[model samples]
Target: MTVKPADRDFDALFADPSTRARAARGVSIRLSGLTRRFGELEVLRGIDLDIAAGRFVAIVGRSGCGKSTLLRLLSGLDRPSGGELAFGAGEDDDVVPRLMFQEPRLLPWARVVDNVAVGLGRDRDAPDGRLRVASALAAVGLAEKAEAWPAVLSGGQKQRVALARALVSRPRFLALDEPLGALDALTRIGMQSLLERVWLAQGFTAVLVTHDVGEAIALADRVVMIEEGRVALDVAVDLPRPRRRGSAEAARLEAEILRHLVHEEPPDVGWVI
Candidate 1:
């Protein structure tokens, strides 16, 4: 059997004993009185949140609730208008956070492997860059498409390539801005599972901004609801992994979050586990 480049790279990554221990540890995030404003339009107001290392937290809310703004701040794509945002100690300061959006944003002219290699930035020419890119493609189950063009891939496949690009550098923090919102319902669910699986394997601090309450409940370690530019509710998921989509517990949590979104008030049912 012919071993493809991706297969070879994937094997090489695991062949090294140090590779198992080389996964970057997730970073702890602290947001103290974080604020953001566009001229007079205040988006995030006096927000304070602390995410423990390796925690998967989902932010959900109605439109214009500043969830995306908060995500951008966390990813360092945008600066806080006031207050402080800090990452925890003990990790390499040079490792920047990665962000994925609803759009794949792949380069049309580039092959899948090359697009993924874009994540390496200045290190794209490093001797092991090809190995890193191929490993990431395998991680996202797209090893076979390594030489394909982005234009030829399906929507889900494009997103997978985008995800591989984000993962290639082993970022300590990842901010997702409704990345699966553009996919079909079935595809979205599959991508969600892929996301959870990769997150568990990579141990990156993940902050997902999504409007789907069920998605938040199903994937997040905790669910935070933002309302009127502030955090209205912070609830722990406290559910086992590989959660059943339509289970009674999932339905209940979904309804509770929806109720809060509709009423613009926190649910009084002790939903904050």
Candidate 2:
């Protein structure tokens, strides 16, 4: 049988076999009538979604359209006021999920390696944790910055460190909330590439929330547009990877997503890049 990327054993890539075991082979999620409300405000209204294991999915919408709120529910950081959120077991379903935000959120007092070690918590003191930390830093190309303080690194480098931190735990599900929104245009593109590389290598289930539609199409296997606290568009990204920015196919996909955005009740503040 042919081995899919998610199914292949990555035992050779990781120094610690348990870390590789902890790595997510894939995770499938099911949401039925998921709802979240704050006082009279309904942030997510009956959201129903099925995310395939190991797929890269991007959620896009206006600033207050519940994209982040939906992600929060998926991260287990927030509970839905009503309805169900379920996960189907996979090879490493027991591994805890990790979240990454636009800000690196590193401590100025901590060295880069130390900040990554924070992801492992008590495991940082374990005999094999050091090796796993080194592996994650190398994956994000920040091995040399191991001893550098967060204040000394560039914005891009700091984000790389954050990526290393999120990865050191070998999470099964990675939820990114505008993780590249703060970087400069050039740096953002570079970071996007780095994120794609790491995701492909690790084969984790990724759900990214972003305002940039192009970035969504560039990395996601599927693009989901949320509007008015629900999913407005759920479509596959059929285009091949390393996709050209202005190619006819990419433009076509972007246009389809924009159509849904433009037709929303309130004007969309988010622009298609």
The count of backbone overlaps in candidate 2 is 0
Give model 2's TM-score versus the native structure: 0.87
Candidate 2 weakest lDDT stretch, 10 residues: 1-10
How well is each residue in 125-187 modelled by candidate 2, as lDDT tens digits?
Answer: 889888888877777767777999899998888888898899888776899999998888988
The runs of at least 3 residues in candidate 2 whose Cα sits more than 4 Å from the true structure, single-residue gaps closed, are: 1-24, 90-92, 242-244, 264-273
Give per-residue CA lDDT, model 1, range 1-273, as digits (tens).
112245344545433234234334777888889899999999999888998877899999877889999999888789989988889764445658999987999999999999999998778889999988988888777888999999899999999899999988888889999998888888888888878867766677899999888889889999999987888999998888867678888888888888777773455633221
Instruction: Tell me model 2's lDDT, rounded to 2 decimals.
Output: 0.81
For model 2, name the residue pairs that clash.
none
- Report lDDT per candidate: 0.83, 0.81
Q: What's the true lDDT of residue 183 in model 1?
A: 87
